[model samples]
Target: MRLTRVTTAELDRLEFHAVRSGEHAKVAAQLLELANQVDAGSEISRAELFVRAGEQWEFTQEYERACAAYQRAIDDGAATVVDARALRAGALLHLDEIGQAYAEFERLEADEPSSLQTYLHVAESLYAHDDLAGAERWATEGARLFLDQVGDPYVDDLLQELLRIRFRIRADLGLAEDALDRCTDTD
Candidate 1:
């Protein structure tokens, strides 16, 4: 394929759009290449690029690549270190490193996550691992911290997802209707 140069600004915008559109996997390789092009002096941005790449891979179910990218970001001191770590932990869960993943989650909980997405990922990861109590704790806490007693359509949407997850978790714990939540009900 013939190559065309992509401006950094345009690249950044494309990355954001790709992620927002849930098509990040299509651009993950480009992001990884851009990350490699970053020099040591630009460590922060380099780390950020790696984190972005990792997120793309993570969302695409490419857990091994996600873990590697996140680790690179962490080792480079990415601005969103906590988020990267949380995502890395989730990817670790997918990798079946349960003991290490649980340890990482416990550690991050002490630090508290730095973003709403981190909270969501941790909660989702725990839920997937059948740690209902842990998932409920994180999801509820995420809602409390992020929703701010007000509603934005976007945050509300995220809130709805969390609520659905929590409902299932509660049911699983026998604290609610024992039948599994279809997760089909919507606001």
Candidate 2:
């Protein structure tokens, strides 16, 4: 389908629907063609289009293309900076660029110190890299920060996940007894 003179909003809606319906490749091709045909005027909007393209590439497990798209979005200063960073980091990890992936996650964490999601991402990266000690440290820090917000259901869920990760990391490191003691003390 050739889309001509359609507003970006309209295109976004169509793309969303297409993705939801699993017509990702078709929609992705349309989006790429459209991106080349139109000038979005705003860097942010263009960046968003690139990010969307990256998402489509990711759905197809094209990590290299996804990383390229995400990097373009980042370079354009897209509004989804954190999300782009996280996705790019994940793509790098899948590509076996562990150091680069860790750097991206660290940058996200540094920018959003209070973000539970950032902490979780860092912990998960460490865990995936077999750095049990680093994973446990990050998970413990996340749990500590989340403890005060336990009344919030979402925070509670995050806290629980952090605790679970910490326990698992400790167990993997043969510090299960220490993990038990820490949990007991926290309770």
Candidate 3:
């Protein structure tokens, strides 16, 4: 394995090709191997390499590996600290590490999420775990807090995710849809 760091853009391009070829699992494994050799530094390239590897591992349904990659990213103190921790929690959930995952989630919630991404991930994980109530709580609150950021496309997209998860959770709980539910889709 090469010790020199690779650019995140290059990693993304590899992911693009891997996905396009329907061979992302193979590429994800390879990226993770590279990530293993990278320094746990906050430098842009190093940090992104770890996070990107985690994301690809997630795509491949390798939750244990994904958790490791995300943890590495977090240890590196990557700029997107919350995002990395949130992902690690989700990966832990997928690994059936319920107590650990919930502990992380509670910590994240107590700290208060500044980004809708955290809410979306936590909510989606809860929803997947059949915790509709928990999912609804996080998703609805996240959507409510970020509702005013419509003009900012990135926040809008994340807000939509939170809204979508909340909508699904509510639907699963047999709850009535409200005006806010309409935001899940234009129609």
- Against the true structure, what is each candidate's TM-score? 0.71, 0.61, 0.82
Over the stretch 62-165, how does candidate 3's per-residue lDDT look in tens digits? 88888988888778765663477788888998889999988888877887878777788888888988989998988888888888789898887777777877
Root-mean-square deviation of candidate 2? 5.7
The residue ranges of model 1 lying beyond 4 angstroms of the native Cα positions read: 1-26, 38-44, 59-62, 176-186
How far residue 146's Cα lies from its native spot in candidate 3, in Å, is: 1.1
Cα RMSD of all models vs. native, in order, equals 6.1, 5.7, 3.0
Cα lDDT computed for each candidate against the true fold: 0.75, 0.70, 0.78
Ranking by lDDT: 3, 1, 2
Error of 3 at 137 (Å): 1.0
lDDT of 3: 0.78
TM-score, prediction 2: 0.61
Clashes of each: 0, 0, 0
Which candidate tops TM-score?
Answer: 3
| Colliding pairs, model 1 | none
